[model samples]
Target: METYDALLASITPGSGETRTIFDPATGGVVGEAPVHTVADLETAVTAAVAAQPAWAALGHDARSAALFKAADAVERSAEELAQLLSREQGKPLNGPNARFEVGACAAWLRAAAGTPLDPEVIVDDGETYAELHYRPIGVVGAIGPWNWPMMITIWQIAPALWMGNAAVVKPSEYTPLGVLALVKVINEELPEGLLSVVSGGREVGARLAEHPAVGKLMFTGSTTTGKAIIRSSADTVKRLTLELGGNDAGIVLPDADPKTIAEGLFWGAFINTGQTCAALKRLYVHDDIYDAVCEELTTVANNMPMGNGLDENNVLGPLQNKAQYDIVANLVDAAKASGARVLLGGNPDPGQPGYFYPTTLIADIDNNNPLVAEEQFGPALPIIRYSTIDQAIEYANALDVGLGASVWSPNLTAAREVAARIEAGTVWINKHGAVDPRVPFGGAKQSGYGLEFGVEGLKHLGVPQVING
Candidate 1:
């Protein structure tokens, strides 16, 4: 039970830059975190590169076993981990919270055990044969975001190691402690640099991405940052998997029930205080049920309790950090100035410390509004009524982002048809953001490049080597 202050004493990185971790609930300083230096990043990369070959040589079974052991370690530390995750990340305890994260981490390890890699075969007459096999791409750099920091970090590390590559993770500056804590528990089961956690801000992350020894980079964050990583990674021609920002649209067709639609709308938009990248930022409802749907959704959203994550009855928690709080606040203000009608909560409570903006719902907005087109990345969702299904699809597809979209219609036939039409990497029919480990998760267009969390994910960590024999 070492405090963050005690832990900071041993760790080096952000040497000169004195930063403090906050208890978001109380607006209290939780502990000090070093803003890592560029040289520290180089040391981490060098360790990962030097340690990776031996780890890769341990072969698949050993690697998979180690991952499972790490998963078990995570499970054993569930209570402590969940509390720490809540204290650091501000996610409510009611939702799957840290328990869900640990389960997913373990499930990923199990799924990776079953995922098989293959060597591509070429036609051979008699003596000559040719095949292409998968080989570890050396060291990988994983950059994780503040929202779901531990879960996404596990997502990045699990598949890379399963494919025989070592990973060096840079957790977001806002929620670095969760990853560091999780890593401390699991690192024993892994080889020295098979998995490592480094803390800091942009400088540390940039160094990791551009490092010559790092063979690939996997990132989950804003589209703006992803673009920078894409440019920086080009120097080494490293393999990249980016799960970037999403201004996802949830389409509520006329065929959908107002009551059911209200439920989906609530979870899709307000889950994680609407901090999820794929959370519904814009809602395109058929004009027929627009009024009724909006009313019901407003009722559901406004009634939910918001407070500290440790409060058992609280349904929502503060935004993870101040910058995100400002982003949510500014978006609400802009939508209002642009004449978008605020149908529900749109303001942060003055008394609330941390980033606690209300579960806001805006109406009478078209794609022209920033809330409709831009990634709000918070608890505010704007509803745009559409006269026709085509109009809804058109608006949903209009954005440069294509991360996730959901079609809410009870009719399977129509929902499937509409889901196919939406230009997003993931389309949930009658559900939103219900992710599974077996599925490939990523995005299309500016949302991001490459995939993670499934069979396809493991392939991304390795390079295809073709040999003729």
Candidate 2:
């Protein structure tokens, strides 16, 4: 196992213009991320274009073997990567945060490697035969978000590589070092230039999206940025898979036991300090159990330790960047101003050095309250009360962005019925934001197009071609 410093050193540029990465937990220096430019992006793209053909020629079995090795490589440096991720991304090492994200990287890589995608026989008659096959789209450009940076980057690149395409990653500016380190570890088992990270700014990302050589672009970030990427990739007509913003909702059915479901609801909303796109943000509790659910949720939230990611006991950490922190603070403040009851943690210490917004749970907030209406994307959740299931579903689906949602109820039958009506990619019964590598996940109605994960996700990474006779 490598030390954290060793892992950080591996990705650090020996000589170049660099950006100082600060630890969000302590405002301390994490490491220097190389400020790569558009020129660097062009060079990386050229290298990927040159490398893709031989990679494709290696065939699926060979590529899968390489990915499996890459997964092993990621495991070898897992501790180092986790520690570095904790420092750079401000996610706790112990929880489903830093270490979990690193583990997810390996899991996703292995899943992409092992998932079978044999050519499908569409039709076969005596007079005619037809089969459907997926071909590599050459070089794929991946632009990842700060939240779950390393894992989501793997989500984009793993399938691309599994399908015999090279990848060029552009990590979010807020958390580049973690991605750089992750890509470095994975590259150890793969051929040179097969996968690379361009730690650059918006300009480099813009170039990557628009570059003619990039046949596909996978982006996981804000809807605004997703749209910009769409426009940029339009001229090149690049195949794209975009997982954008999500203000995911969770409905607590009247039948749900508030005491029993409290922990699940807390973690679903507060995981990674609520930075996840699919993490439950707006929660609608049946009026019959509104007060009970709020009390239970607050009790659960109050117990979870929040502080520096390096601390073993602290499962919650600071926001990855100040901008996100401000967004959360402002939205919560706006909600408070709207006369919403602050069940717990509406106030944060002004003297706190880090962007440590306390785990906030706002109750009696209107569905239209800014905190409920907007994607706060932090350690805050708005609990809204609904008198009817129809009202809850209406509130949940009011927003155009629907990535994931959940209905908490013991009645799986009723839960499934509610799940179908909720406009989102995936809905969990009695849980929320529980993503599986084998299950397909994507957004609906402007939450961004294209599917990810499972065989469908693998298909997204390739271009389908039908052989007809």
Candidate 3:
């Protein structure tokens, strides 16, 4: 296993044009990432196209074995990866943050290797027989987001590679070093030219989306960028899987014990310091227990330490970048101006050097307030009060983006009933954003389409074919 410094040295560009990455928590120089251009993207695509057939010809068993080996590679370098991710992405090393994200990469790679996907016999009558099979899509282009860069890159590429497609990845400009290091580790067990990372700018990403050689595009980022990819891929008609922006809602039913569910609610909304795409952003608490719920959540939020990610005691860290920090700050300011009550922290220390926003909990906010309505992707949550279940459901479904949601209640049947009424890709009972690799997850409405994880995720990376005899 490579040490953290060695791993960083491996991905850091020695000479060419590069961008210096800084730690979001301390503003210290992390490393320099190569600034690949459109020409670099083309070269990567060409290499991927040339290498795909041999990879596809390896058959499922051989490919799965390679993926298993790659998973092992990830495990070997897990600590180094976690440290780098913690520094670059500003998620803590402990808790469900950097280390957890690194572990998830290994788990997902193993899941892609182990999940069975055999051809199915559709019909076997005496007169005729038919079979359905999935074929590789040649080359896949993966565009990952900064929030969970290492894990989400694994999410996009693992299944794609397992299904016999070579991939070219474009890491988010904000967090390129982590993704580059991750790909470097995985490539240790992979065939040369089969998978590559081109850490480039907008032009490279745009080129990858429109490249005729790329048969499919898997993207996880903002809704606006997803739409742009859709437009760019129109000419090539590439199969696209997009997991976009989400302002997920969590409803705390009147029957729920505020104290029992408070910790769950805190992590649901504040995991990865609330930078998750599916983290609960807006919460609706039944009026009967609204104040109690708010009090409990604030208590839970107050105890969690927030500081530099490298500190083991600090489970939460600064926002990953200045732009995201501004967005969260502005939304919270707007909420305060609209007469929203700050239950915990609403004031940030201007003297702080890094992009650290306080763990803020806003109560007594209108359902349609900008902080509640918009996607404040930070450690701030707006808790809205509702008197009726029907009203809570209405507020949750009012948003166009429906990536994920949660229904918290002591009564299982009631929670399931409420979960059924919500329009989202996945709804947890009494929990939020707890994604498992065995389950299929995607988004509803504008949150973007195409499933990732499990057997369903493998099928998305392939083309269906039917044979009749």
Candidate 4:
């Protein structure tokens, strides 16, 4: 499993073609994975189709046992896996421990297990009895992104496995090794082919979406790609869960403290180098406190150190790839051309290599501007001003995407009121992008549908049928 060729033994590649995976921080070739052809995908799906029923038959308790063991394995290998992920993904390793992601995955498995499948019976009018039962939907096609490969994969696949379904997971081509390592350890406790990882490129992803044997498709990535998956899955009518792109807006109300909002603004918009699906991409500030907030945020952004993920003092890391770096650089440069001023960092350092870009802040940008409305998916934040709270909410909801939002106000009641008005799936008052294992998470509107990371997440794998006896 150390080499890319060793990892591809299970599925034979077509044409002997492969894609090179690079370290985002250093632009070094870490490994190579086969660019799986349509045939390779079919082979993997065939194996999943053959293996799913037996694995499902093992029941929930057996699944739980395997997951508990996987948790222990994750803890033992936390250091190595974290190092590998940091190398591939270009995220700060010290600030956010990779073990937290592993622990959360284990928690999801344990919570989803032992969920009763039996029908709940209730008699009405002393004659009629109605019952509700949950059943697994068969094989799931889970495609995870490279931003947080190990975390996002577990978020999508762990619940599916716990609900008695086999998953054929496709990790993003750029960061496949960490997940391969994770699956190897988990498969030790589960049956072979129960939890499989197919390492390849876009063709493999398309095959998974369109495959007839796949009962469901779960995807987390860009909006355009999510649309493609939805259209393809529609032909087979496969069950689908899409957690797509987000232009999450953070509103700083007039009553909000500039100092406090600055902290939330930094982490919400810049975490994972702003590769997060629900990261704050737009900022709406009340006209009364706008200048002060921007000044404070600029100071904080300037002080933040950027470097390779391995550096302990580096709070920010490079963009995961060249395309992302170009996207951020171009968008910021566009803003400057259109009269938007850079209050803080809006340029990359000349000395740094790879896709390293500094934390960027763009002010005086219109809501109609592309930078404010589109999903930038990079470490760039565009600030807009509004005089009224209603106006702020309108501006936030104006975007095509609505995954998450944050409303900051010193007055708790006012903040909750503002948070309630936001159109996104999850809204945090005096906080941003904060989530727990116990609550459901996802997006709404064009941002995408389907829930993840809670009891509702297990329900995503469920099929309901009426038994009229």
Candidate 5:
């Protein structure tokens, strides 16, 4: 393995003012990140705005070629990137964690490169010729989340750069290293400041949202922060793509097989320790198979081991920060106090060094409980029973936040029928939060406006310029 000091390159050695990052797995000091000032963010945004014209003027083919090379660069350094992600992000190195996230960087980069979104020749056959062109928006400010730090940052910046705009990133303070490293890898092949990183907390993010030079804002975080971003952008009325919080629901049909669905159910809720904006938080299962589903889900939860992310055998890891750890622990404790059945792994061992919460399953919980009503962005799943499909649908659609939802049933038609009724941006028939780079994802209700991924994602990143003659 490369020395730990090598990952430090991601953070440029700034002045005396620096922030120490802690390793989520061991709670040890990992490295220092520059406590970026508003001046630093302003500098980055100004540089991006200045750098954008040349990048956009390079034309699609040339820009794509450069991004393709960046993708190659990411693939070449996948190991180092994965290691850095595991150290700071507190996700397992293997499985759908750090390595998987690094691999996805390459995939998303390539997909962005290969996207064929040429100018559309609208009304070409008529007397007047008109063409609609997706033109580059100036500087795009990307404020990313911590859960899937590297991947989420890529999801914003890659498409923004590929669409012929310059991108400035401000990753979550908790998991900044991986994204910084990823950006460093890509910036090697690109023009200076076309892609930039400014590391700080909310103040930095708010500055980006309010920056006049930043024509677009693409953010992924909580719904509360998303509203703030919207408010901050009101000054500039900047275009935005916000993928906010999700209290996603999953409804299992009566005929579904518990054994067959258990693994998916486990991952749907537990992946990234349920920190995902789209991870299924509450499950509404038909009364006929509710007990069986609970049993199988409990078995899945028990079988999986949680530990340091660096361990290859472990699939689950610690909560990336203390605040989130407390949220999970307190919610689980409250659920236990409320007389809900703790099916598996509720008691957290505080004696342990890291912020480790067990894979908890709370059964027979009321819908109004915090674990059910709120977005429990941690490794806890609450299973609720409903007597009919109508009741399940009611429970699923009741929440104000709807980023994603799922319907599990053997009958594809029935699953699709129910999925249509759920008010979410992305509804999966048999899976929850199964995102593809080619499929668009957003939110409904208060989950936030705009979408990410696919052709629509690229189109929205830029302003539509029409030539009428």
Candidate 6:
């Protein structure tokens, strides 16, 4: 909290209620962050709305310059911010942990800065000329999630600013301080109110979703909240970019080498302790190689170290908070009770102080099992057996939430074929949840709408106006 003293001192005190931050590793108090009300959101939005036009008037290059400087600032404070992120979010300090997230943030900001919005000429002739112009929507209300608080906040806000929209961010209450500190660092490079942070819980997020002045609401969280935002934005018909929940399924084909794909499979599902939205949740392996794949994946998962984020050797940390920990615990317990074979970890350790659960693997589970059916969003993974490719694909696409999926096979052509059939916005051939700033990302079905990242994502933050003469 000492790192963020200046920023913390500036925020107006909360209205009676206060949200406390905790270190998931020790279950110790980190600090109490301000619990902003709807009135606070209103003020933030008003200021953002007032500031957006001038910021946009500076043009893309000027905005890009500011973004670049912000990236530099992030890079300079990478270690500090990453430490705060790890303590609050429970992702390890090393590996693809907070440091990696912070670095990716700088990279994303740079990419978003360089990313150009090219106008298209619909009709070009001597008689007439028509073109589609992308104009920035006013203020964007950015709601970030706790899973990758710092990086995802950058993912949500940087593009909005690049597209010339001023952002009023309401970061996840569980991990608000990291984002608040980030915004403090960033707002130094930006104009006052151009990028603002309003910290709170569900009420604050709901208010941002419905706030009349918020021209666009970009969210990174659950599908349930995304649906609510869609409904709330109805009156304003605000532009929305919702990166919602994903219970992504990965299929291991019979032709695939289990030993070779094991490492990829383990990290694909267990990254961020399986808290990732796009992490492979339920995995389907061909009946022939099911045993080999499970054995190999179990070996990899078991070997990975799980402990406090501050420990340099620890690769996996605790669940971000108690609520998510309970959710994961309940699902794994239900799976065990339903007769699913626990090839590895099946439940939380009762003696553990932090929200720690082992890197668990459950085998012989069917879609009927809670662990397989629901988004566990923790360290538990269920391995389901499929008789054939058709059966695997059928079960994988059965879910309403389709954010990302993966097909693992040595044969690229076969993998591509399987990948194409998977019902998801993004599909990986041999990899999973490997996202790039240059490509568009979002969801299909109930996962929500509007693409984020890349040229398509930049356009998503803008309103299309066709100029005809």
* C-alpha lDDT score of every prediction, in listed order: 0.83, 0.93, 0.95, 0.80, 0.89, 0.88
Residues 1-469 of candidate 4: C-alpha lDDT, one tens digit per residue: 2343343333333447777778888888766555656776777777777778887788777877877777676666666667667777877666643445555556655655534445657444566766656688888999999887888888777788877788898988777877877777667677777778888778889889998889989999988999999988888999989999999999998877898778778888888778888888899999999999999898888887888887878778888988888888888888989999888778677677778887889998988888887778888899999988889889999877889999888888988888888999999887777776567898999889988766677777878655545
Number of clashing pairs per prediction, in order = 4, 0, 0, 0, 0, 0
- 1-469: candidate 2 lDDT, tens digit per residue: 5788888888889999999999998999999999999999989998999999999999999999999999999999998999988998899999788889999999999999999999999898888899999999999999999999989998999999999999999999999998998888888888898889999999999999999999999999999999999999999899999999999999999999999999999999999999999999999999999999999999999999999999999999998888888899999999989999999997999999899999999998889888988999999999998999899999999999999999999999999999999999889888889898999999998899999999999999999999998
Quote model 6's TM-score. 0.96
Please state the error at residue 52 of candidate 1 in Å.
Answer: 1.1
TM-score of each: 0.93, 0.99, 0.99, 0.93, 0.98, 0.96
lDDT of 5 by residue, 271-371 (tens): 98888889999999998999999999988888888899889998899988999998988888888889999899898887998888989999999888998
Tell me model 5's lDDT, rounded to 2 decimals: 0.89
For candidate 3, the lDDT comes to 0.95
lDDT comparison, 4 vs 5, better candidate: 5
Kindly indicate the candidate among 1 and 4 with the higher lDDT.
Answer: 1
lDDT of 1 by residue, 1-469 (tens): 3453443344434447756788777687656666777787888888888888898899888888888888887777666677777777888777756556656766776777667777778758798899978899988899999888888888888888888888898989888777787888778688786677778779889888888889889999998999999889888988899999998989998988998778778888888888898888888998899999989998898788888888988878888888888888887899999999999888667976777888888999867887787788888889998998888899999988999999998899999999999999999987788887778888998999898767678788889788998
For model 2, the superposed segments whose C-alpha errors exceed 4 Å read: none
True-structure lDDT of candidate 4: 0.80
Mind giving the per-residue lDDT tens digits that candidate 3 earns over 1-469? 9999999999988788999999999899998999999999989999999999999999999999999999999999999999999999999999999999999999999999999999999999998899999999999999999999999999999999999999999999999999999999999988899999999999999999999999999999999999999999999999999999999999999999999999999999999999999999999998899999999998999999999999999999999999999999999999999999999898999999899999999999999899999999999999999988899999999999999999999899999999999999999999999999899999999999999999899999999999999
Who is ahead in lDDT, 1 or 6? 6
Instruction: Name the best candidate (by lDDT).
Output: 3
Give me the displacement of residue 24 in model 3, in angstroms: 0.7
| Model 3, C-alpha of 224: deviation from truth (Å) | 0.3
Lowest lDDT 10-residue stretch of candidate 5:
1-10
